[model samples]
Target: MVVGEFTQDVDVVVIGAGPGGYVAAIRAAQLGKKVVVVEKDEVGGVCLNRGCIPSKALISAAHHYEIMTHASNIGIQAEGISIDYGKVQEWKESVVKKLTDGVSSLFKGNKVERVKGEAIFVNEKEIRVVSGYEGSRYRFNHCIIATGSRPIELKPFPYGGRIISSTEALSLKEIPKTMMVIGGGYIGIELGQTYAKLGTKVTVIEGLDSILPGFEAEMSRLVTRNLKKLGVEVYTNAMAKEAKQTDHDITVTFTTRNNEEKQITADYVLVTVGRRPNTDEIGLDAINMKMTDKGLIEIDHQCKTSVPNVYAIGDIVPGPALAHKASYEGKVAAETIAGHPSAIDYKAIPAVVFSDPEIASVGLNETEAKEQGLKVITGKFPYAANGRSLSMNAGDAGFVKLVANQETGLLLGGQVVGPEASNLIAEIGLAIEMGATLEDIALTIHAHPTLGEMVMEAAEGALGQAIHQINRQIK
Candidate 1:
């Protein structure tokens, strides 16, 4: 169709085929709305193809290799453990293909139309989708914008051949012999440690005093210690200034916190400073949607935008730029559009980092509760005392800490840093969401010789009845 020559009308139009967009489209369809989703590139968005899924696949392979090579501690010896980068790449791609195909099948099953194109808002109720040399106008009863975000390109280190972004890092056929990571956040820590396990020398540079700044200091210390064990050098309070790249190598210049300038050479520098919301060039100005200076869309509890009948979710809105968070908001927005009374309840949004000795947390921490002037009690237990953790030969170091109300024993928050932390956090997340108290978790019987038993033990410690550890009596 030529520009404005034909108009496709729909009950609801979702302006991105990412996680949030596709979920919103299917949900709208389930609510008896004819929905159409537009995407400029892949259907599964950054999470499926680049950000979450692919990186995790690589991390899994790296972790398996690391554990298999060190099996001598369990009297299991392997002659050699090596990673075939090509095979690893293929496996990662297979994982992505399976997921993206599932998302496509979901759209088909839900009768939601998928359009491949970049959509620019023509007005409040209309959009012009441009794909190649062709264009079409879409008019809808309501619109849900889930355009997502992109990696922020630092001026000092523009991404290219030698200075690459996380997207490019995940796709390398042969892992670089040496790599420099320019951020200490989850992305930098995960990938940097991954390559280290794959026989690459990795160095991480961070502007803050510590890497993984969002995590608690104690949790970060555990990760930092393990990163150092992998021989990944971390330079905190260091600022990356510039990169001079040749065909085969690059020298990166950075300044230390004490105003000391330094330089290091590496095959590639992976920059993961942060992400920027993709709210520009879509003609958001056409509807004058209220947005923050950094391009985050402002929305109500149901994700309703300033303009009527328009909603925005995912990375384009405030809150953590997490795939699960976006999906949650997508559901809320779809429900609100369908005239349902759905609102966001972020009582227990869990954040997990797949670093060495993985870190995960949900709800309030001791610092957060203290900041909010809430009197709380905390109980902690270590993996060293857990039978399951010791049996698996992962009992060296790690802990689970639970926070609860001082007066009522109501669970306030929980943090885990150890083996299977990602999976273990789910139980506590459900506990917090269901408003279960510390006693509830304490009395619930967890399976014997299972990692989940730590949850109950931690809860018991909170109630001053812990059998696994010496309990400090607290009423």
Candidate 2:
């Protein structure tokens, strides 16, 4: 162990260098506050180095490979198509490295001190930073906890050679011939599809009645169809009983919801059950910070924790474990710290799934709206009728659904399950945030031959004025 002492004070100290923590530091610095970000790992955290960027890079490669293999359908004759997994892995690493370096540069540009150490709360306003090479103690006027979360590893399958976590799955040296994904959530499906596209015999085991348990049944059904198209075998309401590793392969024993047991063999197994908050080793108890039953730090609208002069944001607090959600919360916390009355609008935060035909949604869904006792009306437009989707050969799978207040016509929520759904959902999020009525969206003049036009058409459909589809004759 190495020890060094450096005395310095900052207006704000952010723990963790993930999306939320870095964004908070930058925003605080922009507000003319002296900020320092403490990180024990890479500057970009899991989103850039391990999770989002890496996974997307792999998916992009797989998508290209799949398209190239089927080039004959598009009037292009191609032969001798092959994939070099080594090159793909190298390219992905290069992208991650460039982005990580860019983030470090941003910290320098913002004049925020980047400390490479693990921070433990010594008190409300003090922390001890211990590093592998150097150790120091720091003091601050205000602190933000953006420590993020970690993947929950199941006891039956420990992460090693055969059974692995998403982090390891992303860094595989070669695409396994047979793979088993042990989860049905967004992460499992996303990676499972990517591997299947890359020529892996991928099977997904989800311990729920449906894959995306929290999403609407219709949306989940559509996604399941798409997965089947990619040649992925999905087992819903199936629990993995045990994993046995042999010299040649790994066998996973699972039990179905009906109490029938089965076995499957695979070269690799990915466990993407879920993530848990990283509050265990942060010394939150020492600072007397209040946490919920799930161990998430309790915060108000402004992200203020129970301890005075301390705040929390991102996955450490409540809400979805999305990077953008955390980033927005970080900005709000920073602005509030700078004496700028800033509050977060949780209703407008869009959640996106980067699957084949993607999924995106925001605000209240049908069940939530009904549970709230609001009089709601829903409108849907299938992509099968859209011109651009047909041109892209992606028209058959999904549709866009919009929910509005029956009397006021005010947009309440939006859900999409089609190509570029993630991108199209942003418009609805903005509209909902601005409190736009159905007519406001219907008259917004969406461009022709684009996915965004569907938003307008859906809104118009709700108002009984859609041009492409037959109007619903309302009594």
Candidate 3:
């Protein structure tokens, strides 16, 4: 030990001030533990600062602009509608500042000390946090790692000036006249569609057979149809070979599904393949921490790592790289550290894609149930048959689908593709979480002329008692 240096001791030290880390710090503090958070960048991490919040702001702006430009069909007229993208970005930044500031306020209220530095493990019991020329060590009784993950960079498409990642895509100074998107996962699709609605000529290249491969084919197809309506081009089973950037534009070359070569030019190319866990640089090898072959830290239900006192959550652990999921695990890890029997339950983790009309799902869909050898029954109700959807001009857009055990009528899962899908999926998530059955959802009377009624209607259809749509009689 240095003569002038002293090690700071805390009851809990959390790495990364993102959704997972900060939440863990607050929960631990609430449970009477001295907490310290080590963050390399901004306090809110990528989700609030660069990813989720900012992108959603832009998506909302684009959606409003699209609606205003085409309101004539709804017995209303909007004229001379234009978007000042500069103002849009400023407003988006304001929204981000408010949320990040709120998180910081919560930290201060909870008395969690935040250290702005990069944290590296010194051993199983201590860590060195370095900020520029200064460095400090923290000895913690327990540690929670919520380091999260980073966007995966592809070899063929190294990010630079014109080839940008989502982090850069969200902060662009000006909206491009044309944009090329690589990878058609949720991130790419969301951003691509946002720009498309904003009047940018957008092209999407997906390596798989379909975009949003994690979602149901029917649901994703609706998004694909909407993309075409927005004048966006989509290519599936396509490989992005290379990119050539000029001062004014970027030219991307790729091979089609049939092995034919093609090229497209755009102002910028956005890459959103996936995210990799931020586990490499934190010096996990020093503590001999266990991880998967893919570099994900191994954690049990309590988010406890192999070293009992050290824990990991969020993108570093096995599960979807979602902010809410990380936040949930953060609380569970904090409770477990406080000697509570808290554990993780992943049965009802809802995933939502904010594309045009949105797509949301929770638990097992029909295909998944059938693959697992469970006798399943499915019911679907189109948005067109719902009065609220018709009144809202979304009648031809999407539908609600429900999946359940045929024998027991227990709700297994639900998928929604339409307006307010993100909000509507929560009911299904709660249903699955509480072990609610089809009859439970159907028997609960939903208010008339509301999108929520579709849930009840879908449930009723599954039981052969649908009112708005034709029912399927169980033999």
What lDDT, from 0 to 1, does candidate 3 have?
0.94
Error of 1 at 120 (Å): 0.5
| Index of the highest-lDDT prediction | 3
For 20-40, candidate 3 gives per-residue lDDT tens digits of: 999999999999999999999
Model 2, 150-264: lDDT tens digits are: 9998888988879889999999898899999999999999999999999899999999899976788888888888789888999988999999998778999998888899999
* Candidate 3 wrongly placed segments (more than 4 Å): 1-5
User: Which runs in model 2 stand beyond 4 Å of their true positions?
Assistant: none
TM-score of 1: 0.98
The list of candidate 1 runs beyond 4 A from truth reads 1-4
lDDT of the candidates, in the order given: 0.92, 0.90, 0.94
| Residues 404-459, model 1: lDDT tens digits | 99998899999999989999999999999998999999889889999999999999
Sum up the clashes in candidate 1: 0
TM values, all candidates: 0.98, 0.98, 0.98
